[model samples]
Target: MIDWLNSTALTAFGVATTWAEVLGFGTGLLNVGLLVRQHILNWPLGILNVLLLMVVFGAAGLYADMGLQVVYVILGCYGWWAWLHGGADRASLAVRATTGAEWLALAAAGVLLTGGLWLFLDRLTGSTVPLADALTTALSLLATYGQTRKLLENWWLRIAADVIYIPLYGYKGLWLTAILYVAFLTLCVLGLRAWRRAVLA
Candidate 1:
């Protein structure tokens, strides 16, 4: 029993960095809705998550994702301030869905960004998973922006990305990260339901 416990601890230590990232990602999704609803506590939690994700993605050689975390850090701060002060007479921010035109623009931008990154990284770096990396990176950017704007469709984008991310991370031997994405899939579902209810109610 002692030996089993030791093994478990060792394995956990090996994945400690990824575990932090998982916790952060989970909190981030929850924070997104909370922020959309103008809750004051979302920023700190989001900052914590983005900080951890920066470390994890950097270690994994996901440069774009690492950069995305940096953006998240900035956006998280901006969002915190905006939620608190950018409203009429400094009131809480309200939830607002993205328009169809904006969604199309975002989608087009995602495709262009993904394609551009794929081209550059495929030629400049010797990454084994360039295409998958590019796709996930681009989609994450879109989802993050959508989240910032309180778009109801962000959950759907996250859901689609996680479906691909799970297999990709698993293939790269990032089992813990893959598990996180799997959990993210579940959270996306919950987020969708929760937000839909909020929209209806």
Candidate 2:
């Protein structure tokens, strides 16, 4: 099963695209599309996407990103529950802007997480892109957390991470994943606009 997943699905533009990356890409598209529509099914698809990409990133020696997938699984589950019952009196979550305090907290967390993960990856792992990996991982965590809570700023965080991830994945030779991030960046922008409209409505 693992072998099949890692096997090349296709070669395009001189890059061999793996089945895992293909499936992850499909699921990622669905996940973000659903999220943009405020649909509840995005979480399960996102979990599957992360699981597939965990294999892809691990193969690319992107240790921090591989580990980020593991964290994403946990956050995905929490997000699933949060979307269902994380609102006032356990209602479905509604989109909202982040509070000033939440912004401060997320900023502090991003800095600390990026620094710690960078140190660990740089000193303890064979990762070549430790700083970029750690930075994206930290931003992704904050974005996923904010997303779970239906915070509007999550899209901005994701946009930032996706921009960085494009070049990082390309440099790692994961061209398919890099392209997926490009699409994700677009989706994040759409998500941001849609959620802002939701907030206003």
Clashes of each: 0, 0
lDDT score, candidate 2, position 19? 98
Candidate 1, 96-179: lDDT as tens digits:
667889988998999998998888678887677888888888888788777666667888888888999999877766666677
| Tens-digit lDDT string for candidate 2 (25-119) | 89999999999999989999999999999999988899988999999999999999999998999999999999999999999999999999999
- Model 2 TM-score, 2 decimals: 0.99
Clash pairs detected, candidate 2: none
- Candidate number with greatest lDDT: 2
Candidate number with greatest TM-score: 2
User: In model 2, what lDDT does residue 14 have?
Assistant: 95
In candidate 2, stretches whose alpha carbon ends up further than 4 angstroms from where it belongs are none
Candidate 1 segments whose C-alpha is farther than 4 A from its true place: 1-9, 12-39, 87-90
